[model samples]
Target: MRAGGTSELKQPSEEVQQLLETVKTELEEKMERKLDKFLLVSYKTQVVAGTNYFAKIDIGGEELVHLRVYKNLQGEVSLHSHQHPKTREEDIQYF
Candidate 1:
C-alpha cells in the first residue's frame, strides 16, 4: 500500500513469544495462593470511568471479607475493603 514495492511483514519472534509465556506462567503462579485464608482482588475490566468488580473471601466459618473494586475518575483502579470481624462491634471499611 506504500510507494515502495516491497511489503513489511510483522511476526513475533520466538524469543519474544517465550518471554511472554514465562510472564504468563509467573502471573498464574502468583495468583494461585497456597494459603487457605486469603483474599484476591483482581481488576477484571479495564480501567474506565465506571468499572465495577466484586470479590469475596471467607477466612474462617464466620469471618467474611468482601471487596468491591472500581475505577476512579482518573482511570485508576481502587479497591474498597470491607471486613466483618467476629468480635468487632463495627465493620471496617477502608480504601
Candidate 2:
C-alpha cells in the first residue's frame, strides 16, 4: 500500500473481530436496523492517526453493506460510515 492508500481485502483478524463486536450496537443504531445473521465477508484498511476499516458485511438475503469503522490510536472504536445495499461483486472501498 502507498503512504495513504487502502490495503487489499483480508480475512478479518482476531483484533478486527473484537473491534466489530465492541461496536456492534453502535453500528446497528447508526443503520437504524438490527444486524441479525450478518457475516463479515472481507475488509480493507487504511492507516492514519487511527485505522479505517472498510468492511463488506453480509446481512442475510440480498441486504449487504460496506461499513467504515474507525479505531483510533487510543483503541477506541466507532462506526464511521456505511454504504448499504451493496452487492457481492462490489469491491470494498473508502466511503
Candidate 3:
C-alpha cells in the first residue's frame, strides 16, 4: 500500500498513536502501584471474609472507619482496643 493511504491499510496518525501509548503507560503504572499496595496489605494482614469486616464497620456521618481483623506472626487473632490476643480457634466470631 502507498504511504499515508486512505484505504484500510492506512496507519493511525502520530498524535493518536502517541495518545494511546500514553494512556497505556499511565494505566500500567497505576495498576502497578495498586498491586504493590495490595501485596503489602495482604502480607501484613489477615484474609477475613467480607461479611466479617463489614460487620465491624461503624459509620457515623461523613466519617468512615474500617474495622479489620489481623493475625499475628504466631497466628493469633485480635480485636481493636483489646489488651490480649486470642487464638485462631477463639476468633471464629470475627470470621
For TM-score, the strongest prediction is 2
Residue-by-residue lDDT tens digits, candidate 2, 10-63: 986776776776767877888888888567888999999999989887888988
Structure candidate 3, residue pairs in collision: none
RMSD of each: 17.1, 1.3, 24.7
What's the distance in Å from true for residue 93, model 3?
A: 47
Q: State which candidate has the highest lDDT.
A: 2
Q: Lowest lDDT 10-mer window, candidate 3?
A: 35-44
What is residue 34's positional error in candidate 2, in angstroms? 1.5
- Whole-model lDDT, model 2: 0.84
Stretches of candidate 3 off by over 4 Å are 1-10, 30-95
Tens-digit per-residue lDDT, 14-36, candidate 3: 43233223233333353353211
lDDT of 1 by residue, 1-95 (tens): 23322123224344323322322333334445332454332212222355433333344445544444554676555444333332212232322
Clashing pairs counted in every model: 0, 0, 0
